[model samples]
Target: MTYTALNKQVQSPLTEQDKRIIATIIQRHADEIKTLWIDCGITVWVQLQDGGRLAFDRNWFAQRVAEEKTSLEAQENLHRQNQRLEAELKQACTEYGLQHGEIDYLMFSTKVYRGRDLVGFVGFHRFSQMWTYSRRATEPDRYARSASDALAKLGVRQLTMV
Candidate 1:
């Protein structure tokens, strides 16, 4: 039967035989059935010829839509946060007279200095997701404040000085 005829029949009150015929046709053209239920003011359930049933609740549909919207919003928020972090990093690099490439290349061997005195070695630690500093060959507590200040100026929040 043509889709127009099937649509007209579905719009009208259906008898048991009519329902069976519609179910059979739907099973044969499952991909073409974009909308399963019409405005009959009643929940509709149809068993296909293969014994699989097509059914859904309006409440379930609404819940799924809400979930998708929440997921999209969370993704957008994460993207914005990443962008803000990147901008902050760029600004910090410029203010500290440091280049991202230099930091990356000399992360492990580079020494951070305050004026003419060497405070510590600056490097990025992958496991801790932080920039770390190892104090020079001296007391562990020495240059702690200077190391903290230097890392802060570079926008490195996750910093550890030892």
Candidate 2:
């Protein structure tokens, strides 16, 4: 595997110490995390002003669907369905990647301001099974509260309405 892009714009600047701080702060709110994110299938992906982005882990997702699907399929059709599901997952991830940073495609897009400066953006979307992709740009604020709370934890102090 190639290990290029050290200090390049494409490189992730997160350090081991930074990761530990984030992990520790998050563990303190396990219940809220479960309710706001895990139980609801919510995602609050961030893209920084410097062009760095943190997106959903597609490889992990594909592996997760593979494990969950075996239990949902009959013995004879399991392999076939698994193959189809894997392909569908890949396609779905590709489409999400394409639309992720675009404001027009977002159900809710918020500017993350740390103090007075524009530091990054937190884009929220409801993810689901392979077939159910986002269609409505104007989804209800039923999810916005949870997204806002999550962004607050990420150090976003304010949001400029779009």
Q: List per-candidate RMSD values in Å.
A: 14.4, 23.1
Q: Write the per-residue lDDT of candidate 1 for residues 1-162, one digit (tens) a residue.
A: 996687657754545544433434444453323334433544444444455556546555445546655766776775665455345445544545444322333223255444465545555443354544555434232122233354564344442334
**Global lDDT scores for all candidate models:** 0.46, 0.36
Candidate number achieving the greatest TM-score relative to the actual structure: 1
Off by over 4 Å in 2: 1-107, 114-116, 128-145, 157-162
Instruction: Give the clash count for each candidate.
Output: 0, 0
lDDT of model 1, residue 157? 45
| Strongest candidate by lDDT | 1
| Pairs with backbone N, CA or C atoms under 3 Å apart (clashes), candidate 2 | none
Question: Candidate 1: lDDT of 147?
Answer: 30
Ten contiguous residues minimizing lDDT sum, candidate 1:
139-148
Which digits, one per residue and each the tens of the lDDT, describe model 2 over residues 7-68?
24333455444333333433332122211111124432333444443434544444544554
TM-score of each: 0.36, 0.20
Give residue 51's error in model 1 in angstroms: 20
